[model samples]
Target: MPTGTISKRSVDAANPESKDWLLWDDDLPGFGLKVTPAGGKVYVFQYRLARPGQAERTPARRYTIGKHGKLTPDQARKRAKDLAALVAQGIDPRQQEIDAIAAEDEAARVAAEQARLEGELAFENVAATWLDHYENEKGRRPSSVRQAKLVVNNHLKPRLQGKPMPHISRSDLQPVIDAIPAKQRGMRRSVFAYASILFGWAHKRGDIPDNPLASMVKPQAPKARDRVLDDAELVFVWQASAKLTDPFGPFFRLLILTGQRRSEVAAINWAELDRSTATWTIPADRAKNDVAHIVPLSKPVIAELDQLALAEQIKAEEEKPDGKRWPKSGFALTTTGRTPISGITKAKNALDAAISEAREKQPLPAWRIHDLRRTLATGFQRMGVRFEVTEAVLNHVSGAKSGVAGIYQRHDWHDEKRAALESWAAHIEAIVSKKQKDSKVVPIRAAL
Candidate 1:
């Protein structure tokens, strides 16, 4: 009901809590200007919609059109006109405002995706974003994402993620990569090598300056694992394995049957096994190479798992041991209540401690749990197992040239492979039993 024009100067001077209203000289209705707590003045449009039994004395349902800074008082007047037009058509301004925001959000999302496609962000940056987006946000498997992150974080990002595509000279790359640990040198080389491919991909889209790893000296390192387990240390660990409980006993034994990483075995789930098929399937998400593998279980390995009903009883009792704090679920070494074993370190510490205690009984070679896997691999090779079977047992595809065959044409000869595993397990059992009975054992080095 207010009329005429209110000046900016008058508006600024008026008390914020003033009950009296002022009019703005504009062609549109329901438009107003106000100041925020910061004293920054802005414009807004407020209006009402009619409903059944609406009274004249009822407060006009009000909603904000825009901030004064974003929409000047004049612009707010125009928006008020639009709101009036919508109201005239039986639409509520508040509902229309919400719909507009939703549409804008959808547009913004599409724009962000298009920008990502066009930006040619560095392979390192783009990959990092993708990993963060797909792996962290969308819940892609952790192992796959971690492997990709490791490649970038350890090798690619340090040298190339920030480099302009064109400035990636081999001179800059060679020294950066030659620094990764020798054990992972081949993997290190492949990462930078992959950076070149990503850079080229970015360059084609005008995203990067150039790919730098091109024409660089490739890293030199043997990409094969050939470590063998020692004899004296073997007897000590075998003794300790029996002293542990069922699942840990079976788990510690599983490592000997399978040469996979500690993380891989610890994360073992029921879905990965099929005793009916006599095989274990490691999904690409859980595998180190990001490729699925089929392990042909031998009788002794099968027998070991069968003893625990395929690792069921131990899985059920994960986190209830004396009400101790436990890790999250899904592991080979849990005690009760679906906990991952916190004792990865504790288990290894106990291993070293046991070895220390038995040092007088046997001055064994310094060995790790991984040594058991190596010994099994070495034993199979000595037993005339094919190198392919041995490498496949370790789930490696080192010599494969064809990508399709290397990844796809995998077959698990469970029955045949079981013979080799049984032979190895029996031999270790014989060695273990012999050491248990033999009491002549003493520290080769005499105590001072």
Candidate 2:
């Protein structure tokens, strides 16, 4: 090492005498310029650690300041003095650098840990979040939103509940696909689609860096079911419903009698029905089309609703206290009256059992609760109900009323709707009355 005031000219002129060497700055001790064998010059600061009680200087530690040309001699001297000040204060610049690096590493570790915990977001958690967004945040159809929840609860969460987002791979979901029955291919496809959409939502929100199911090929398209119940099945549905208990029985009858969706009929609140006018008004939020719907309550529909209301009133009376009674739930088809009747699968199973028990030789064909809605729509078309009127009764926004026609044709067909439902109800009554008389003479046959 050579000691001197390191100048730009001197530094540029300095040569490595057959090897790399350091030229120390005399003005600022321990600060020097190194001349490499390749003729590159860089500034460096060198110092020894301080001792507590011992007089001897500890081992020296070196710190690189900057390059020669990048930081001029003056700049390097100023930086070197600042570092020398640290040394004089009994601080090790090298230890500070090491501590700074360690601190940075620790911070990075903590960040990584936080990210890891956040990444632990499971399929069930994301499903709930997605439902919240669907119901509360976005203007989505309630039916579709409910379907998403059903898909998550019945299909998704049961399979992929606790698994972390990133750790869930394609293979992780294979069992879910395989477990679905072959007959429910449509449902299997729907579950996959719902999961795919949910995971995609999580990915877009940066909850997960990537969607595991993004590259997954969707399940094969299911065979479309257009099986509508005929006149005989309608009779069987009407008659067999009597065997089912309260709420479920009336619920089934209303599905056929009103020609409305299962959810629509089941979700009817007492307040929604006007006993004077015999009309049920479904709010825009509850309607599948996102529009308010008015359903004319025919004699049969009104009778069932009155019966349910009476039962609720009796229940309220029974649960009454000293000169005070709690009001019953506003729901039309609720066992608890507080919440609408759910666990439809169990209800359907009970209906199936009753149907089987009613007709000994033959049972009703495998049909969904939605099939009753389809049956009503088919029956309406068969009974000479106008297309627009039937569409109004069903609350459907398709066909001639789908596009611009829907915007222009604002006529709610209030009178026509009432007539249509009345006609459908009378038609159903004829079928039921005919079946009652012919029950003993004829044997129950499967739908043709």
Candidate 1: 10-residue stretch with minimal lDDT:
439-448
**Residue-wise lDDT of candidate 2 within 316-412, one digit each (tens)?**
5654333222123378787774788888889788878777777785678788888888877777666566788778888889997899999999888
Best by lDDT: 2
Counted clashes in each candidate structure = 17, 0
Give candidate 1's whole-model lDDT: 0.61
The worst-scoring run of ten residues by lDDT in candidate 2 lies at 439-448
Off by over 4 Å in 1: 1-127, 133-144, 154-175, 178-201, 223-225, 241-250, 259-264, 275-278, 283-350, 360-371, 384-412, 435-448
